[model samples]
Target chain A: MEPLFLEGKEDTPKIILNSQSNQYLISGRSLPEDATSFYSPVLKWLDEFSTQTVADPNVKFEVRLEYFNTASSKLLLDIFSKLEGLSENGKKVTVQWYYSEDDEDMLEAGEEYSELVDLKFEMKTY
Target chain B: MENNEILTKSMIYDLFKEMTKENITLLYQGDFSQNLMKAILGLTEKKMDNIEVSTNVKKKVFNVLVECVQNISKHSDESKEPPASKFTSILMLGSVNDQFIISTGNLIENKKVESFKSKILMINSLTSEGLKNLYKKIIVGHSLDEKGGIGLGLVHIARKTGEKFEYRFDKIDEQYSYFTLKVNISKIK
Candidate 1:
């Protein structure tokens, strides 16, 4: 329905969803004080998007997270699983995982997430 | 002494700066009563890569470090002080010659020593591909701890580093043990 956007923090990442453009972006560090509270809404938004998505929706999900803790990694997995499920059900999903050229850990993180899910993922080095 | 603590972290920074020009100085999951462990990991990952390095070396270090930190976060639980106190654990990312090292330390439960030893022994024996296969098996076999299972972390550490993870479980009390594990980050030839 409406746009869903949450800003990133010095310790947390920003989440932006453009329902109109069929584009979603999650960027920054993710170690929220309360992980469940932080991720539940994002999951909810994705669920809603799946239902009210635009015609011929080719969703572009960009992840440029500098870091995420183990707990947040689980949350990201949950989100990707959902996206994977949506894609499996014949929705268009393209994921771009961004990392600085020097950030090996971040790149490997993207690789781990890619391994765990079945989405169209492109690991981009900035 | 309270104010002096800040100097230790600063000194650590200086030491790391001198150790290598790579700037891989992140410490995690120590002493803060809350979620300091996660904070440390979050901060470190932001800068844990060296773009100048090859993809193979980069992947090797990244995987080892993740395993090391996850082990620290999941098992070690020594808070600093005053009952609900914060504690300090140190992680140093540096190179000895050309090989990178990920060192981590935290408090442990004395009783878990045997389990820790066995896991290390088991992990050190596997080849990289074997470790990967084992990880997949664990995932499919539903092997998980109450929080999140780090069974795979050890295997990944062993395989990625191509070296035994050096760990010392020092006894603090009958109930507590201090454990430190170091993983070497050199791609296996």
Candidate 2:
């Protein structure tokens, strides 16, 4: 499978999903004007990644977003739902959500996501 | 001719004076394209960086501002007068005492005013815990509307600001009304 790498922009987040390296990271700001269009490719990539066989049985996905708008919030839930599917298929999927020490909102966002999804979720403060 | 020029100059001066008196940091009125929205956010981010506030508050202001501006861009209706096909809106960001007030006004269809007002009222009626629960429920159950909105922007704003939304709707004509919304975010923890 091909690795997906998209550089972060002023309004979009950086994305890196590699099966061989086993490093799946999404970090930076996400407040695009058209979030649905911005995240369509990402959702497609994740959908493809879920259907394929991978080398690693255990996957740790890291999310370090500084801020994201409400539209992007919905998409993040979609991303987590995809991860949940992978977990149900017997892969050990863990989500490491990182937030700034002073950012209570981000921490709460991670907590809410954790409650909604069935996965090993960890909230870390930087 | 000289009197007309004098009147125009005085009008401009009065506008400046009013804005200054209000302590407006930014004011924009016109079309809100995607590029313009990004530029507005960038400009506000820079302005917010200089303010002596915690990072959390700044992020909250920025987040709320994004939702407000996007709301205008997404839902504001066009005036049916001279310019029949343009979305024109006004955004004003002012600092009052210890709070940052973000105000936006735009044209909206008269038929939708009731629903919009009720949405705000319902959101304002929720406590913090209730707002959080509603946000979770909506995010989980709701999908994007025809305009690409999941209807979570107001809920998110209410949750972040922890304040009631101030809004008004003035009838512009039989078809449309001018809608205004004001959201305040306190700098103090």
- State interface RMSD in Å for all models: 5.6, 1.9
* lDDT tens readout by residue for model 2, B85-163: 3547999999999999999999888899999998899999999999999888888886576223625889999999999
Q: For each candidate, what's the DockQ?
A: 0.10, 0.69
For TM-score, the strongest prediction is: 2
Tell me the tens digit of each residue's lDDT in model 1 across B119-168.
Answer: 77788777777776675555434522422455655765665566777878
Deviation in angstroms for B97 in model 1? 3.2
| TM-score for predicted model 2 compared with the true structure | 0.94
- The residue ranges of model 1 lying beyond 4 angstroms of the native Cα positions read A31-37, A88-90, A99-115, A123-125, B1-30, B33-74, B78-95, B134-147, B152-162, B186-189
Task: For residue B151, give model 2's deviation from the true position in Å.
Answer: 3.0
Tens-digit lDDT string for candidate 2 (A1-126): 798999999889999999889999999999887787888888888888888887777899999999999888988988999999997666789999999999999999999999999888989988
lDDT of 1 by residue, A1-126 (tens): 777888887656898987776669999867553455788988998888777747766778899886554446667877998898777556889899998886666776678678877888899987
Q: How high is the CA lDDT of each candidate model? A: 0.67, 0.88
